[model samples]
Target: MSALQALRTVSGKLQKTQIQVSTGLRVATASDNAAYWSIATTMRSDRRAISAANDALGVGAAKVDTAYAAMSSVVEVLSDFKAKLVAAREKGIDLDKIQNELDQLKSQVLSISQSASFNGQNWLNTDVEDIYDPDNNKSSVVGGFTRNADGTVVVNSIDYSMLQSALFNSTGGGMLQADPRDLKTIGGLRFDYGNGLMSTYSLRNTGGWGPTDFNFDFSSPITFGAGDSISFDVTADQDNPADGITPPYDAGQTTSIVIDAARVNSALGRTDGTIGTYKEYAAVLRSALVGSGLTATTYTRFEPPGQTQTWVDVPDVVGIVHNGLASKDGSSMAISNVSFNGVTQANQIAPRAVAYGTRNSEMTLDFEPFTVYADVVVSMRLRVDGSYSNLSFDKDFADLALGKDNGKVETSAEMATLLTALVNRPDVIAQASGSGTVSLKTDPLVDRKSGEKSMIGIDGISVNIEPVPTMNFLDVDVARNPEMIDGYINYIETAMGRVVSGAAALGSLQSRIELQSNFAKHAMDMIDKGVGRLVDADMEEASARLNALQTQQQLALQGLQIANSQPQPLLSLFQ
Candidate 1:
């Protein structure tokens, strides 16, 4: 090659090396190496974006931590409230003071919810209107990065909603809120026995009887003269004289209604019959009277000779006033009204006698709008020797129709007594349906604005009441009645469970947030390392390259000087 051409080539190589040493990069701009610079720039941008996303994740984690902390405080407060409730159940303890303490603890929960906020995001204290919105309630945090072929970048994130659960929610499942109560029927009717004696007997007890079971307490005993006989008959007889009187009488039993005067006179005069005279006839007749499942009693009143003596002949009466039933088999006869076959006995006034359930024979009667059951009760008492029998009883109300004022009792005494008798009555059957009012139960912690049951959520932790109270817990009078303390204790225990569950929920959420936070940090470090591999300068390689380039520059300068000297020698030859 010629001297000038060679010199130009070496000078170009020297300029390139000098630039590389000064810049410390092989591809500083697109012009340097378009493909390499482009790759490095894009990769650098990705790293920055990833770092920014990680920063956002950090902020979100802070907010979650704050919520979790608030929930922990709420758990403490609820625990204290439960303790106070337990204390309130103690005898002679002041409930009002205990309630005051509970109220304070409740207030603490509210305060925690209100203050549980981060970066102006208050999840705990949010209202129903705000949290009900799907978009508003849901929170998203930066999670990961993705690049598409379309040159678009995507940032993935995690999302979750802050709301109350079964244990704690502000709207329906929270510690401070009440649960809804369903409509229900009232329980069994209780008898108001006058002397504080209450009993509920099932009409199914065919063998059982009440205090006064259709007894004929005669004022005076009848004296049977010659050719005189009394007939005893039962309207619906199941059996004749049998080996034993079987109750719930089956079919095919013989019944009789005849009276023999000759037999009666013969028995009155016989010593075997225990009746030598007419005065002792009634007592002997009771035993001699024969009928299936038939029972009798005869007693004499203290009176002078020649004066008629009193006697009592009736069915056996037994059983408590208000027992539910003899058996739960659900088959029992209902008594509506009683019929008397003869003159009334002692205290056998029409209204009072029916009210006291001392009537002779009862039967099943139908009635409308019955307060107890559909079928009315019918009972009876027989006075064979009396001149005549008169019956007076309101079939529909029976004994319940005493001192009626608009079909209701007017006098308290009569009302109480009548109610007592009705409660004590044996033949009155207990039916599932009746003309009774239904009681709608409700909880005490209902929302003030809507009066609907709602729960309260604090810091993502929820506590709630379940199997909602039939009555307001605050209104429960456990202090007055010692028997009610057990219920109150149960309520407190349930509340404690709610609080504990809430705390556990918060703990789980906190762990998730922590793991995500850690992942975000790790991802940032990995991204930084990747970007460094693409664009960051290698100082060791750059330093070595700089020294080599400097030596090449010196050699190029010396070569150019030598080429100029050769041109000078050529000029000498021309001289």
Candidate 2:
């Protein structure tokens, strides 16, 4: 080639390399412009992140929707329960029959509670926390229930203090602590299957006690049912006699105690807790306390009414600290002002004060009735309070709580916290849906475990019966007066209505949440877009440059060829 041609070729090569290096790219600006490539890169990265965020939000929303759908079913079941109650009231037959219906309805409620868990988390089952508030003397108990996969559920809330007074208050009502003496000395305890397990606790000390080893002459776990019935006489003991449940003190002076199975297991997919069928049986508790004209320590003394009679007559009903909390005597009985059937006579209690003594053996318990309409008010869990004034009756409350629900956390927060306690604590389990499983479309909702609801309640559910059977559960015989199960249904109806009303409020809040969530997502998207715009590549610009670069390369080659022709002329001259 000619020297001039070679020089041009070398110069062109140098220019190309310099362009490539300066642009930090082999191809930039059609040939050396690298701006488009950089733009494209930035856009793609930003888009990917946005896509990921969208996916996450989408999944979350879908799960929430699923829960909502499930809750719809729960609502339906509750409606049925209410319908049944109305029908029963109209049928009006035997009070016993009505009781039976309530019993059945309660079972359904339990069934739903056990079965209503989403992804394994049970909203009805609430969790407990140790709240150490630095400010005022404030203790807290908060929790909730949610939907499940197969059936409805009764969420177990974990609010101890509130629950205690509610459950066992002869005076101040709320949740209540059971009588430890009752645990050690049960009036009627009959278990069929016998692993030969009989627990007994004593509280003779001045404070909380344990494993007092109360004697049990029970003839094994009597597997006998109706027809093959066995009549066994119940008494204090051969050794202690009617020692009056030794001082309500500590170890040497303990007052209460509790005992029950460590766990609850069922072949059915039910997460049964300590209080079995609380809906049906809650009346038994209420009847034992309230229905029986027994005033418990549920309500505070100076709060409202009748803190004297019920409290003093039954020093402790359902294991509550009735009468006065400690030393204060709120009873007007000291003035010989006690009466029965309008007979103001001196009723003397043995070895103690005389107040409604004659009515001791056979007490007259009032009946508000055990009512559970097809609805529910709330689902919650119970927690034990460590701060026991005494342990004389600790075992009773613990035993009842554990034996019934199997310690799955009580479904009523105020009731559980207000009552159950051993040391001064909140030994409550947290209820959440199975980490990833979806329930009635609700994130934190409650339904019956068996899909069955009460006659008057709204938030109850039960999946106890298998095969997802028909919703036709319990029957009611409504011929008798005072409706044997009136209180339960009534309470449920009242409670549920409130719950539903409250839920409506929550729904409003939920709408707000949705709005906020959307806003957050939009804001996040905008931020991401801005970031991407800053760094993402513009593909269209890049593509255009690539095409232009190809054309330029071709032109450069042609120019070089022409430049080489000059060298050829030089060569010819040389020739």
Candidate 3:
């Protein structure tokens, strides 16, 4: 019975070993080893999931590679475009040909953007109305899959923004189509007046027309005899209606000055009351004007005939030149109602109205290269020659000014033209130069030299636009505006830098995906090894066990047979 039981145990052991060797798993079912079987099953499932995740990473990596390639191509094309623009800057070059080359380069960029797609995904070209829409303009790629300690599975993605990566879009929001510079900080219009003529009136040098002082020249010199007196009403700050004028004009103070022999002698420090030359007459007139509480000055020196500089002392040939105070609060000054008694050539003392200075009224619209949006509105009130004109700039205004319906100002020159049209005044000349600087000046024809009324003031200058890039690469025209070549180059360089950054970003994503893929593969191997330790049979151990069990089975079977054969010896068995 013992031998029979031993044989049965060996047979069971041999069968188990054979099964282990065949299936390569010791704990193939819950009955073999419940704990190990459960753990190994779970681990095997996890390994399969990791393998799937690694495959997903490959697809993500391919997408990144496609985007990176396109970005690199874009960078190269932008470099060539910039070079073309620089070449166009040369003074006698055929800018039209260079522009044609630039157009071809742009077209190539468009082609690359449109064709840089993988699995119907194109990151470079978009058609959204607003790339700034965060939810709409964002793209993502599956980056990784993870299982938490609590047994929850999760998938993660690598996200990228198309705002900077997009090379072209239907809306003007692409890197190349959008303006790249912020011009919202540009200064408002400024008024500038040229420097006026200066004159001195006394030997004591106590009276002289300083810079910005308003002055009028006499047609010829005048000799004043005893009892000679000249008088005139001088108006200062004429634009100020508060002083005396009406609406559209500010008030200004009007005062009178009389020059006589006594005043001349007094100014000359002589008690004798003797008549004096025009120089002495001017000195006394300046003193009298000062006593009358008026801002006044006189000219003792005059510009020599046929000479620009080196003004000699006022000679008998020169007339008495009188000057008024500088304009106050942007007001003008004028002298009128003149009368001369006992003075020769008094008619030659022709006093013309003059602004405080020869400075022309100018307002500079300083604009940096910046993107102008469709909704942007530049509005301001311009005061020209005491009349106010409201000026507003927008897409509609630009379209009308350009005689086109396109809601875009194609160039800085076009912007200047639009502004000029907005002002719509022959006296106010608007000119654009060097990228986006717009200078609006009172026409030289209306300047003090031309003796025409000239004044410019800007108020409420504002634009309903944020500080953002708005320049479009396709709109660049170096042939028509060679001066803007530098601006074009700057914009292209900026776009290229962005493209390079995007490429680097894609490269980084590719590296991450590769690392994750490698990690997934390694994890799979580790999981297989761990599950093997839990449920995989060791071939060397299983083989040795099988041999030992088989040998024991044979020995037990012989022992059993021997016991069965010796059963006839009843006496020996009983003993």
Candidate 4:
């Protein structure tokens, strides 16, 4: 019975060794080793999940690669487009041909963006109505898989903003189609009296004019008919007790000048008694001043329209003229005691006494750096020597005058240059110094006695602010609007920067995905090794055990047979 029991134990041991060798697991079921079996099973499932995540990472990497390729192409195309725009700025180039090339480049950009897709996923081209929609304008790619200590499994992904990568969208918010820099008004006009007092006037409304001696409404043409005349008294070298200079009270000379058709015709060297144009009328008035003993070099200087070199030809300067004449020889002048015959009030040519040389009318503008996003419009109406000159600075004017890529005055020096170009008048001098302060004044007149320099006034100035319209790279038509080439170049340069940035983002994502894929593969291997340690059987050990158990089984069987024979003999003896 002992031999039989030993034979049964050896048989069971051999069967277990055979199962271990066949299945290659030390704990194949819960009955073998419940703790090890459970742990190994869980590890094997985690390895499978990691393998699946690695596969997903491959797909995500491919999508990122496609987007990167497309973005790189777009960057190249935009560079070429900007080069063409720069070439178009040349004086005699054929803008139409350049525009055709630009069109082709723009079309290529669209083609690349639309065609760059992987598995129906496109990052450069989008169709959402608003690209700024937070929820819809983002994309994610599977990056990694994680199993927490608490036994919870989670899948991780890499996220990217579609807004940054989108080059073309059916809606209007694409990077290439939107405005990069915001329109901003940097500086405005203000009266600086060289004293501590300064004042700013509204640009939109004309009611801000402070105390004035005379207000003339020349908004329309004046018809000087026969026998019509206007007269005003002019005084020179007037003595004042408040002038701070020793004075013997020398009586200044006063003269009256009559402006009529007879005088105008006499000034024009014609007997027709008629002035054909407004320019001719202005010339007649200037000549009358010179003929009335006021020196042409000192008193006849007047401000012209900002757009022209002379005051007589511009219509916009005809409204609400202001006077700012000064003497160059320390002699004061005044116009007063006005009388008009046959001149209606509709002409608004009323005259009043004004003490010249008492105050300076020059203005200074302090400009801040342009850092906002909006269009800026500066409207100014300056009065010099009793005349009006209207000037406005907008994108159109800036482009025409400066021909800069951004079409904006970014610095005080740039503003001065733009103003100088826009005014185009020799008498008006605009200068920038000490950071961003722009001093606008007429050419200085030297005082013959005291050697004091006197600058005529630049008054009635205002500024207007407005937003610049969005300029799209695709809509660049230099052939039709040749003036907009600067703006086009600016927009294209900004768009190219955005495309390059998006491409860089994609490249970074590609590298991350590759790293994650490698990590997933390594993690899977490590998990396999761990599970193998828990449940995988050593083949050599299992085979050796099987052989040993078989040998023991044979020995026990033989011993059991011998014992049985002996038992039979003992039983016979007992009978």
Candidate 5:
């Protein structure tokens, strides 16, 4: 080779070796090797992305751990609360003290939720933003890093919706929170008797309106003389019947007729010459008054010579014999009293006889005013205090045949039914549609875990934590009714179940985050190693190459020197 070409070749080889030895790299720039340099740069970028994803995963794991811890604390608090409730259920336990402990445990749960935060992120304490879709509360952490075929960077993440769970949701019903409850019942008749005593009487034995198959009992028969008479009067208020105030037989307008002694002994005969047969006399008197016609009002009586005596408007009666000498008492009864509507008669009437009378002889005389009729019958007047009490049937009695028909008592059965209805009316203060008796109130909670309009009375029991206008356990005097402690135990157990479910959800989410974090760490390490393989310089290999390149540079320089010396020899030849 020519000296100039040999020197130029050696100089180029020495420059290349010096550059390789100083730089300690196979491909330093794209100009050195386009394909390898581009691939190494891209892989290094991917490794950095993996590191960032791992950092995000760590942060997410911390948040999940914090939530998990808070949930665990809540579960413990609920457990303690349940224990207190169970203790309260024990016979003769201090319920107030147990309730205090339960309250404290609930406070602890709230405290834990508020304090459970890591790196300025509190999952348990805060509520999810998306209320409509609870699952939209995505608290995911990046788990993987990758490059798409289209040159887009793809990051894979692990999903965690722990905060959206029912336990931690504050806007909804959380584990630590509770709603106010009111009393509700099914199937019962509610009556406010005010301040009166409630009493029931069996009235099936009593007659409807007439002298129902009733007879007189003679303790002993009496022998009457020619100049003795027994008299009694029954008066009815045509202006006012039942005192228009109370119930039962309140809305009735009735008439009263009196049976005098002259009509009983003279008109209706005693059968025996000495008036021994009293029952037959009483029957004859009752029959005569039922068909007889007389005035309904009171007036004076006048008599004309050899003519019949006339009463203008005397208390409607049948017989009109007004002679005291012809009247006689057949039965030897001294006193006879009347009673109606749980009240006794004001006065008693005694029988009179001129002859010797046995003390035990008794007879029943039916009065016309208290007797029965085919169409219109006289009703018993109810008295309150000294005066007669009345009721306005149009305003008081409702949905009854007697009230609708305007007190025209027809049959005995109809009258009995009306009585029953009136007696039961006091028990029904209000009406609703349910089994037995049910009282309903408004919704306790508007929105909660499941949905809106959560009712207070779910089961037969009501849980009350606040003072409301209704009855509740808080207002219950446990000392008076010791059986109420058992109910609180059941409530606490139900609350514990809710807290446990929340804790379980938290644990599951925590596991997911931890697993994703572990995978992210492992994958990031692998990616770093791969990037190192693609671009990282091997120190031992580079050192060996550096020594060899240094020797090669020295040899190339010697060769260039040899080539320049040859040019010097050629100059001697030219001399």
Candidate 6:
């Protein structure tokens, strides 16, 4: 072998060994720095993680900003609603036209309310809703809110599928009862007794309300002899026996009388000079006496020996005046005294009587809130989503009726209710419909003709007055208003104002969040750059270092060679 070849081989081996030790790696080529390469590769991975997290946070901020912006639009819409409601109170204004404008504005408000969204996550569009109140640490429906049964976290989450199933009554088994109640009816006339109505008898001339009346007739026939008088029962006749302001003038004199049974067969046709329907009965007795010739003269008035409030003897004269006429019985009519022209028909006057029911002093009827279910989804989270036609209600306005003009909250809750019913109502509302207005009701006006209206909501949430469901605007009811309509009217306006205010607040919050998100993104970028400077190797700098390491290694090789030569000289001396 050539000496040069041996030297070249040994030098190659040393160079290879130096490369491993200098680089501190098994492989010297770029691929040989496995550990260093591994570190760089891991650093790149960590950088990516930071970048990803930054981008995700940025997106979250953007979502929050979008939600806030939507709320701003909502505020404007709410303002419009308030203004319109307030205008409705103008005395001489065209209420119908004003209401039309109000309806349009309300629709816009609802659009804003429901259309709010943020990064597909809706802040206002809560589903299993909840409200936090530090005061009570609890929420109540009295304020017109719906929340989870346990009331922990706000159920402000809604799934796409849940929103999708909204073309009809998809809640529980509501579809089974979806048909309108207008289809129900009752035939013929009906009577209603307020609190009390007399039956068969009413004291205050209630007989005028006729079913019928009970009556009896009496007949009397009699003739008077010299110094004689008589009285009798005219049970089968047509004569008012007793009905008088002043007595002693005619047979139909007294309105009340007692029968003089002893005088039933009186021979004469007179008594103290007062005649009654019994006069006819007296005529009968006199006729009999005359026919028998036993003294048509048997008609006689006699005075017992010493009677003071005395009966006077009848005179031959045809007319006379006296007293002690008749008396009355507690209940039944008893026939007695009479002054007869002859036997003719006479009727007996009977008192009118009736039974009464117990009276009721006061009564209160409660009208409650209603629920509405439809398949109209609103996109109020972001402007991009707010324009959607898929609007719906959160099951709070089901069966509101006419005359139930109850008030509502000024928050998104009001918006939700109005949107669900007014936005897509099949009749007076718009949109594709569900078991909404047609299936449910929240109107407060009755079709005076149809006379059919929802009495109340299934939830028992009452209305102050029923909305008059119409092709245009609904009628307003201000029943027994303590505020005399003004306060109520103001309340409506205030509600609208509240809605606007809330929207504005939400918008402000969104703006802040968006700004902060952008700032955060920029800050994160700067931080990552700084981190990279901290521990990651620079490719160019590393390459330069490698060159320096190579030079040092060559010098070390020369030093070793010199040291070996010195050892060889020592060996020569020994020789």
Q: After superposition, how far is residue 561 of candidate 3 from its true place, in Å?
A: 1.8
lDDT of 3 by residue, 497-558 (tens): 76787788778877888888888888899988898888888899999999999899999999
**What does candidate 2's lDDT look like per residue over 58-115, in tens digits?**
4434433433333344445556666656656555455566456556654654454345
Q: After superposition, how far is residue 401 of candidate 1 from its true place, in Å?
A: 48
Tens digit per residue, CA lDDT, model 6, 12-70: 65565555455544433446466655544544554454455445655555555555565
| Model 1 Cα lDDT, one tens digit per residue, 1-575 | 36556556656755655565576566677886787678878877776777777778788778777777887787677667667767776778887677667667766777787788899876566544333235745666676676889988788887766544222344442343443211111021111212111111122100212223233333443333444444433221212112122344333222233223445446455423222333343334344444322333433344454566744433222111111121111111112232333322232212112111111121211112222221222232211111112222222453445544223222334333343344342322222122332111111122111001111110111112113333333333433544555565565555556556655765676677677667767766776666456545566776676576667666766776787677787798989
lDDT agreement with native, every candidate: 0.43, 0.30, 0.65, 0.65, 0.42, 0.33
- Candidate ranking under TM-score, highest first, comes to 3, 4, 1, 5, 2, 6
Q: What is the TM-score of each candidate against the true structure?
A: 0.47, 0.32, 0.54, 0.54, 0.44, 0.31
Worst 10 residues of 5 by lDDT: 199-208
Per-residue lDDT, model 3, residue 276, is: 47
Backbone clash count, each prediction separately: 50, 221, 17, 8, 21, 91
Which pairs of residues clash in candidate 4, taking residues 3 or more apart in a chain or in different chains?
182-373, 182-374, 183-373, 183-374, 183-375, 184-374, 218-318, 323-386
Measure candidate 6: CA RMSD: 23.8
Candidate 3's error at 176, in angstroms?
Answer: 1.6
lDDT of 4 at 47: 83
- lDDT score of model 5? 0.42
